[model samples]
Target: MKPQLLFSLLLASSLPAADAPVQIGSRRELFADSFLIESFSGTHLQLQTPRDEGVAFKFDQPWEGLFSGYATLVTLGDGRLRAYYRGKAVANKDGSEEELTCVAESADGRTWTKPELGIYEVIGTRKNNVVLMKAHTATHNFSPFRDQRPGVPEGERFKAFGGTMEGGGLTAWKSPDGLRWEKLAPEPVITKAMVPYKYMFDSQNVPFWSAAEGKYVAYYRVFEGGIRRIVRSESSDFRTWSAPVLMEYRHPSMQAPIEHLYTNQTHPYFRAPHLYVSIAARFMPGRRVLTDEQAAAIKVNPNYFKDTSDAIFMTTRPVEGTAHSGVYDRTFLEGFIRGGIGAQNWVSRTNYPALNVVPTGPHEMSVFVNQDYAQPTAHMRRYSLRTDGFASLHCSYAGGHAITKPVVFAGRELSLNFSTSAAGGVKVGFEDVDGKPVPGFGLEDCVMQIGNELDRKVAWKSGTDVSKLAGKPLRLRISMKDADVFSFQFMP
Candidate 1:
């Protein structure tokens, strides 16, 4: 059945007398644009789920035990992947001597092995995977990122931010490789005095060079109305950051129930670097899932089993001149990764996500999570998702259609990452900003797009080339049946 089409879709049903086209600049944009999706008739935008790959690495070292936090993973140039997290056996106030930053490596993200760096001796052994220790309390949550900014010093190729305001705000560190570290500044780079908030910089404060904005971006935890929330700050250099502003959620999210976000695993998506994705842990304080008996069986910390939490996803396309204006789309308010099977999975802060999501294979990306925290079974588990598969414009067998706001572009071909059932298919049509279908590019001209593909070019009887439409404001009308369009990009 042909899906119904809407004309000049607006933020409302009644269109402005003569609405101006949404002037999408000549950069590659993604379907992640929630604002573009003005309306969907019988269609819905769906969030994709990550498949669990069990334990990627375990915190079984004698020195390491329950209470591991701030797991960070990075893919290296040497064809290896590195995992970093604090190794602690028992609960200690944030920066106790018990906390040691540990390292684990993997050739493939699946099987991980900890290499004995033997750099710092903790737990009476110089033969463990301890990377940073006794370096003040900063190692308690040392969050690191590969500094890919242009002209970054060889020794400073790796950068990190750690420590709380009580431990002296956040201190900067540099590493030639990710293993060894040195302080960028003797004093903390960002302090409580810099921001108006009193209790900021408490969790895994993450900072990375955003190639899109050409600045250093950091997402950290801050208290608001006594509830945990996320804030954003920026810097041209890693040493100094802009004042932290509470991140605001857009339309649907602003309307949804709020929860405490523990650690925001916010990072630039590898494919769409401009779109920052956050797989943040939604902490449900005092929301107990395990009874005392169940908690005792798992040997969870007495204080830990009282609450439970899981991961949620959000995205933002940061613009340069926004101070507390960046919008986060919590399109999916439900848990991205739910606690499965066991009561142990629901214990306090067990499913706190790591800092970054790394690509493990050509078609797949993996996110590491700190699971079973403060329990004897505490370890890191991996969740896998197809490339560009975080969210999709989805429809069921009943089928539906969506019309995008007018956008400008510069490309010869339109490519989509999508999947469908045998009977499901997708068809796309182009229209001028005025809501008039382009000649030879109407829905009737489209050849039904079927099958699953990472990059499939949309075509019509007029052929796929649309270079002539470059820079002209246009809209896309997509109709689908039992299919999901994960993402789309126009390529020159």
Candidate 2:
């Protein structure tokens, strides 16, 4: 053997054995540390900004004026997308009497239509899309989600929770079809008495059946030490929930500064059900962006211009067998969706995102935002990102590198969703679990991966065949220059 080839084989043989390969099935595993990662240089993890897709539909209806917000969008199993939001024409405290839960449907995420459900009579006309009406405080923030749990009752195919302290804590509602809703219980299902905090259920309290944890989970607003913070609770059945535990951020060394997260739209990423993504409204209290003159010119609600807010992205991985194991990563603390051009976009509680991100087209997914809040133009605007393109392992023109702790994956070929400038590129090399370079797949053997592609294959002189590494523990040492790797997976 050549001297270099002999040394390479010796190094590979001397490395310690790797831990068992993790069975990361073809789910859209994000680089959000859903798996362990280690050893990096010069690279920065970046959050991809969503491109504004313009007004999805204006909240121009008489019932849905300036105060319309707290939007929730869900994709039905039948391929239809449904949008539900609270509609109010005037500004008032949470759970105001004028608030009503409204619905809209879309064949494609673009081009929405509000069908007259005729389920509830409002303003002497039953021709509106109001699904739940006059339900005490429940309609003030009635956020609904399509129940996808196995063996869920046929009559309770859909579920929702909404109510305030005055109206009682959170109440449960069920519906067979998205249109008709009935209270699952007369009293509050999750009451204030059940939580450690004094106040609860005031904001957009969200709940969804967590398939990852095999139970129901909710992330609700609570005042902890006089700051607006979030707490999580779980339930075996929808009626009874566990006591709330304050959720803490476990960010990287570059921790995100403490701030008020008003509305936490925490839900599992549709493509990657195991990863919970929170598109929250980060409120900067007293951070005024508009002068009285500018606010008056835009005709915003009087009380809404004093503070500013924007949308942020966070994630948590609910570990099984551990109670309250949802650890939130706040590493990327920047705004995922910034307030747009005008004073209208930065008003208090504006730029709040809708619930789940749904597939809009073949290569894209969309997330809706409540924009222009408290202004005449207040409406849900649509924004989009490439599928599984939330955070990326990125490096600048100066170049950088990163490595995985140890991954045991099944599959023949490794696929990557990445992008790079014409002058920038990336290369991959495999290391034994003990950090020794594997033969034939060393950095020098890797072909320079150039261009931007969603599913590009990584090749080396030995070809792209990585079946030999299947079902075995290994590590990946990636080197890149001016490039971003959004996600990667071992494929058959």
Candidate 3:
């Protein structure tokens, strides 16, 4: 389907309450949103933060110094990992002469090394790892992704967009092997003339070929009413785009406060391709934390210490056959990942996460973050999270239970990604839409789940098979005590 037509068919409001049962088929669903939830007795949705796994690599290279930022981690078809970021030694304008793009490579996502590409001469040396140089503002934020569109030619296997409003607008860039690059068109494809926002294209303007949408979707930056927000557009051929749409946020219960979102690192979750996860930078313009003594001790840039920043989590689903929701579900308004325990971490724009969260292991995924910004100690740090574990239906020791909305399934058994304390556990039961328990799948028949596992099949007193209940509209009650249910899906 065309992107414009897909976008036009989306619901005006993403979180509309309906009485009819929703069809989920066999796709995995996370508790990150309230779409499948009806009500809760004592449980709540908890936003999960990845565990810090220490430094992945540093910007200590000659070309990639303290000012190097806007990093992106891409996993290739052959399992090789590519890390790209800007390289600048000192603070300068967006399109400064010193600004250049560099790449680092890794077989496994944990260890990264910058290869001596010797592609472009920088700092009077040809042994550097520079990819592109002398590209004006485009180098400021060059974002790329591996295009997964069905018939996308091998020459266009990779795609990218980079530019600034001051430099005209976003220009299209493409590569065959992802090592060498070239512009798809000489002129900017998305310009100010197509949008109403005043300031746009300043941050990491991310674009990707969405498998669920079957079209190219671009989520970029824009300033409306002086607040740094996000705007989205779509294209079928990667050259022309649809009318700009300002993304709105919705919650199941309350309205969330609006803050400056510096960069919306929005992309489809690798496991659940239909759900888009955004580990965004929440910027507080003047929320200063460092004192003069602390700031000077760390040798942070004088201009950057005036404010602080951290990362936040948001999700956008392909609601009701629509490709892009054009709305984000703000389930938990708090920071998904907060600043660390040092004065250096409280500095301005220091905790901004990288563009994508790539898997480092079979059971582990990693989110790379730019840490210690504006200082000589600047580097990218790796944080680890369990697979499909972004948010969860959490319950404390006090114990609580939640019931899901009516949903029809197509599988034989249910499996979950969950964690629990030794003394606590989780249980699941099936019920009708009117709250009547199903035979052999009531609360009493559930076998308590104890310990942690990425995928554990739930069992009843009878067996783990639920194929008898397949194709029938029913509700699920998740009861827990000091446990977290990250995600659940039916298996055939």
Candidate 4:
């Protein structure tokens, strides 16, 4: 059997039966299927091909001189979808230079356009060209890095976390508009604590903003030769970060070089409260020598061996509601390699049985994956849920309270009916899973306001008012002095 097939089998054998009942609250029901093994058809997901396609702004020439390295997708303030990619232009046939930090944008996720003003530029000759972005005021040195995960917002700007070359230290950047970015002082937010270890760096830094804790949580890969591990950190105000905590999971063998990984945002899947996705890449030993023509095209280091293993592998996990503090109930998918030369030899032979855990409540989640390659490919997937048996509520509280039963929704629209028992004194609003009220993103904050009146039902639904929730996972909160929620349901 193919490695991919065997991997699936192993995963399947380890999982509970599909019909098994999962407990949520005092009720028991089959866990909703978060991932659809087959191609999904809807506004949320498109281009379900098996090929390894990188994220980029839609362009007229879809495949022309596109930078396909580690990439991140962000929805800008102007309602434009932007892709910040490790831009490397295709070199000329004569082995000339062409590579830089690139940026692209799309009104819709499907169509993309490269902006004239690229984010960062690399200068010098083809062989000696170096990255020309501002140095981290913290480190005061130039570094090679990629895979940037940007946070929602703080004040009027956004925060991003990524890794640097050599020591692989964690770095931070701030952007007012997601396009024009500025480096922050006191770089390397998190690093090895004065340890004797030689190799210490952060790979695939993904941040989750928590309004409940009023802090930021980051997950990344910690590399130790022959061993790739997952680590996490917490920060407040994006300045100082907590030390790294090693996760229990690791690859079976260290034969392959693991690069990076990511976690998918929490969203409703099937009918579950929260679904999380993650992807990672492991580069097996033995490299492929490229020809002069191919070498000139990509303009990569001639000495570096080409990646010969699978371009991507991913797994999914269901947050067991509020009962569990961390990840539980996991599932693995041995992704099929499509497109790119390195994908030819990739195979999955392990069997991953389905893993199921009882539902606890809605929890913060993220998705990470490696996207560095000769052709530099990346993968993204979308999931949806039905909003039945879910309700949205608005509340006013100085402390955090866990909604034992999170409101579930179908597609991405959240509709709720609420009322306040007081006069026109205070305004009621809704917040996301992080607790921050999203303005314009409707799901962030209350797009519609409710007047204070005892037993009054106010009907509200999210659409263009809160565009961010258009196709993303979300939660609701009410910040009114005397607000009470009566009913809530999501629409397809």
Worst 10 residues of 4 by lDDT: 349-358
Over 1-492, each residue of candidate 1 has an lDDT whose tens digit, in order, gives 100111112112443333556555544455553756867898887877899899888899988888887888887888688989998887778888888889999988998888978787765778889888877778888999999999998999999998887887889999999889989999988888876665877788888989988889888887887888877788988987776666767655358566798888888887778788888999989887788899899888898888889999888876533333345787778889998788889898888888778888988888888898888888999999988777788899999999988777777888888899999999999898767998888888888999999889999998898788778878899999999998887887
> Predictions ranked by TM-score, top down?
3, 1, 2, 4
Ranking by lDDT: 3, 2, 1, 4
Q: What is the C-alpha lDDT of each candidate?
A: 0.82, 0.84, 0.88, 0.36
- Give the per-residue lDDT of model 4 (tens digit) for 245-315: 44333232233333432222222222332333233444444445455456555543343334344433332
- When summed lDDT is taken over every stretch of 10 residues in candidate 3, the lowest stretch is 1-10
Per-residue CA lDDT of model 3 for 1-492, tens digit only, reads 533344555664443468879888898999888878999988998878789888889999887888889988999999888988989888878877788888988888878888888778787888888888787588899898998899888889988998999889999988888868898999999988887777888899999988877788999998878999888888999999987777878778788777899989999998888889999999999999999999999999998888999999999976664445688888878888899999989999899999998888989888999989999999999999888888899999999999999999999889999999998999999999899999999988999999999889999999999999999999999989999999999999
Summarize candidate 2's per-residue lDDT along 46-94 as a digit string, tens digits: 7888998999998888888898888899898889999999999887777
lDDT of 4: 0.36
Q: Evaluated with TM-score, which candidate comes out highest?
A: 3
In model 3, the number of clashes is 0
For each candidate, C-alpha RMSD in Å?
6.2, 8.4, 2.8, 16.2
Error of 2 at 229 (Å): 0.9
The number of the candidate with the highest lDDT is 3
* Model 2 residue pairs with clashes: 21-408, 22-408
Instruction: Report the error of model 4 at residue 39, Å.
Output: 25
